[model samples]
Target chain A: MQAFDHHTPQTLPEALALLAQHDGTARVIAGGTDLMLYMKSGKAEPETIVNIKKLQPLQGISATNAGDLRLGALVTLRELTRSPLVLESYPSVAHAAGFMASEQIRSFATVGGNLCNASPSADLAPPLIARSASAHIVSADGEREIPLEDFFRGPGESALHAGELLQAINIPPPKGNAVYIKHAPRAFMDIAVVGVAARLELAAGRCRTASILLGAVAPTPLRARQAEAALAGQSLTDDIIANAARIASEECAPIDDIRGSAWYRRRMVGVLTRRALTALSNAQPLHAR
Target chain B: MAKILVSLSVNGDPHELYLDTRRTLLDVLRDELGLLGTHRGCDAGDCGACTVHVDGLPMTSCLLLAADYHGAQITTVEGVLDDGKPNSLQQALVEKGGIQCGFCTPGFVMNGLALLSEKPRPTEAETRAWLSGNLCRCTGYVKIVDAVMTAARQSP
Candidate 1:
């Protein structure tokens, strides 16, 4: 890896101040899984690294007063996977966390790092976007909340400013069942070729509301708004689900990469979208399961 | 660049050292402490060759900064064996044909050990998922899975 100075900050304010002082020359290191790889590959050559691992306040899983799930920026994927609240209330998010890298990588890869890294193929994005999650960003000025949907700008990019630090992700309790599914060449540690996250609020055997997010098939994790519109106020029948999946597949603009071809990814999007809907159809309350 | 003081416990032994701020846990283990069992293959996090147990959970040591891990406990492949004797997983791997070229064996062993720590008797699917990150280009993973299963059965 390239040589760089490292600073371990004990507080978020301290970390943000360091970032501000360094004028974005410093990269905040949480898990360092993605950042370290970038540094090693010469993709990132920051002058300094501000380590936020020592900040205890930015850790844990909790429910806020607004009934939203609050996840600290430094909360590792392993912790998220093991959190009963996440598994029970937001199985899609938990499942997405579980499917990330592996048990070992999950132990250190933080959700904040995953989001800030802003890789189009990031496993956490689709799930969070489907759940209508929001990001809590802290900078030298103060904190601001941004919906996860508005967070990503493009590949390897995010809405975070130069000195802003992503504090936590707030996931509003889903109104209905949610499921995250991905089609990777292999089950573990591989990036998704096409990943889908579906949230459906069903009432009296009819879909009252829905949100479908697609990943690895676009510049960023994108909400399949057209497909979501097709599912609203309709029963998830074979034709309806198939049509919705088709719309989702059509909405995505995937690019060919080493992980998969664009054609393969588009095909998998349809397959995964259908599967996610099917899974959501049969899904029971997490506690009962 | 000034070296930072890092105090950490490795395999039950506490040690203090001064290291460059950019040094990774993998570097500290192999270069500073001379614990070369933590093989450094694919310095990137893609490969689990440099996996080690940090605070009882398996993590990619290459992704961790040594200075930031002050007071953290790390267990490497060398720590998995008992007094130079191969652990049950290691023995099972030998018996089950899990070892071929042996470059990836240590990582597999460490990952297997970490898995059993979490799930004492993991199902076949669970075992496969746990060892998925540790790549074994030589054995094709058939024997590695068998070895973990056999080891679990042999334990207790």
Candidate 2:
């Protein structure tokens, strides 16, 4: 790894000030699970590292006044997996957190770093996007909120400014059931070939609203609008689900990669989407098995 | 070039060290503290050979910086046994033929100890999930899983 100055800031304001002072020359380190690897691989080489692990404000999980869930930027994936609120209200989020890299990595990988890494194959992005989450970002000037949908610009890219820090992720309480399913060649310690998250709000045996997000099949975590539209206000019959899944496959622009081929990912996207919708329609947890 | 003063408790002993800010917990353990029992198989977080207990939870020491864990309690594989007596998991591994090349044994033992500490009697699936992070390229993981199950059953 490259040599760099390091500052352990005790406060968020101090961290933000250091980031602002260094601007593009400094990078914030939370868990360093992803950032250290990036630095070792020569993908990232910042002149200074502002360690924010001690910034107390960027920790914990809580409910917002709007009945939404707010997860601190530094909240580890393990905490997400074990949080009672996440387990009960957002099972999909918890399931996604549970299926991340491994127990060891999960203990150190933060939710904010996972989102900020902005990988299309990011495990947390699909579920959070499916739940219509928003990101709370803080900068030296002020703070701003960005919807999860608008947060990702491309793979390994986000809308965060140079000196801005992601404070937390606010996921609105789901009005319906949600499920996340990922297809990895191997079950553990592997990246997803095709991941899908489905949120279904059913009323009187009909789908009132739905949000379907696809990962590892696009430049960014993307919503399958056509598939979601197909399910809205309609009963999720076998045929309807199949059609929606097909539409989701069509919406994805996957590319051939080491993990999987574009064709295989497209095929699995359909399969996983159908499975996710079927599971969410029945109000079953994806990882229950 | 920047070094930070990190105070941490390791294996029931408190020690302070001045290490580079970028030094990982794994490096600090092996290089600085001479805790070589924690193997460094994969520098990246994929492999859990560098697993250690940080505040009673198993974490990949390779992925965490030593500076981030100020005043944290870390337990490595060397701390699993008591008074030279092997922990139940360690004893079970030997009896169940779980020891193969032995390179991955420390990690497997530590992870098993962690699981058993949390769930005294873990189901087979739970055992599998707990060991998912620690990869064993030898013995096909059958004996390892069996050893953990046997150890959990033996737990009081």
Candidate 3:
């Protein structure tokens, strides 16, 4: 780690001012788990390290009376794993949180950090994107919101502009069944080879709507648009699920690395998609159950 | 080098020190504080040999910056002593042959304390998952699992 000045901002305005003061040379830390690694690797050399853990605006897990879940940027992933609200409302999100890193890492890692890091293998992106969650950003000027599906720009990049910080991610109550499955070499503390998220509304043995997202198979966690189109309005029979799985396998472009080969990841994408849909079809979601 | 003032409570003792932002909590404990109980096996967050408790949550001390831990309550391996005696987890590990080379014992005891804090009695699966971060090469996990089970039995 390089020697640098540290600032603990108590308010959103103060945090924004600190970010503006450092311009692009500053980095914001919520949990500082991945930030320290990046700094040690010389990939990030920030003159100012802004700690936002004290900010009141980014510190809770509460939902609105209108049924929207607003997860603060600083809310630890471990909190999400055990939050009764999350388990009762969104089990897939909770399960994904558990599947991420070890208990030690999850105890300090934040949901916003996971999204902002923009790792292709990040577990939260596919579920949040499948739910069509929206992100709220804060800057010196004001606040703005964008869909979580469009939040990641590329590997280790986010859609945030200079001096803008992600405040919270807003998610609406599920109108359909959603599931997330992670394929890893180890049971815990392993990055996924392929992660698949699916949300489908079923009606009279037919799929009324669908949203299928794939992770770790591309530069960004991407929505399998064509495969989603294939599942939409189609009955979730074995043949239909198999076809959608095939389309998903063809849709994603993966790279060969230490975890797995490109061909294996592409193949696992199809397997996980089928598995998630089959699991969703076999049992009712936790909320519905 | 930039210097920052950090206030930390280690083992219930408050210390105010001026430190570089680059220095991690693990370095502060070992070098400046002279508390050698915590071992630094891997600077990266993988090995978990520097596992410590921050605000009742177990985390890798190597991953935390001293500056970022202002006003934080930290518990190192040296801090888990109860009345100058080994805690139940440590005793059970000693009785159950959990230590061979003893390099990873502190980490295991710290992680075990975290598990016991949450649930006095946990299932075998839960105990295994909670200690997944800490790695030991000398004695493969059979005796360590027995130690955790014994500790749970003694406490619960």
Interface RMSD of every predicted model, in angstroms: 1.5, 1.2, 1.0
Model 2 interface Cα RMSD in Å: 1.2
For candidate 3, write residues A237-260 as lDDT tens digits: 888888999999999999999999
DockQ values for all predictions?
Answer: 0.70, 0.74, 0.81
Instruction: Compose the digit string of candidate 1's lDDT tens values, residues A4-76.
Output: 7878887778888899999878888888888887887898988788889888768999999999999999999
Residue A133 alpha-carbon offset, candidate 1, angstroms:
0.6
Model 3 chain B TM at 0.97
Candidate 2 lDDT, A5-110, residue by residue in tens: 8888998899999999998799888988888998889999988988898888889999989999899999999999899999988888898888888877887889
Q: Of the native A-B interface contacts, what share survives in model 1?
A: 0.75
lDDT assessment of candidate 3 = 0.89
Scored on chain A only, each candidate's TM-score is 0.96, 0.97, 0.97
Query: Each model's C-alpha lDDT?
Result: 0.87, 0.89, 0.89
lDDT of 3 by residue, B1-156 (tens): 999899999999999998988899999999989999999997888877899999999998988888888999999998988789998889989999999999889988998899898988989898888888888998888899899989998874
Runs of candidate 1 exceeding 4 Å displacement: A282-289
Question: How do the residues B41-109 of candidate 1 rate in per-residue lDDT, one tens digit apiece?
Answer: 888777788889999888889888898798899998878777799889999999999999888888888
Ranked candidates (lDDT, high to low):
2, 3, 1
Cα TM-score per model = 0.95, 0.97, 0.98
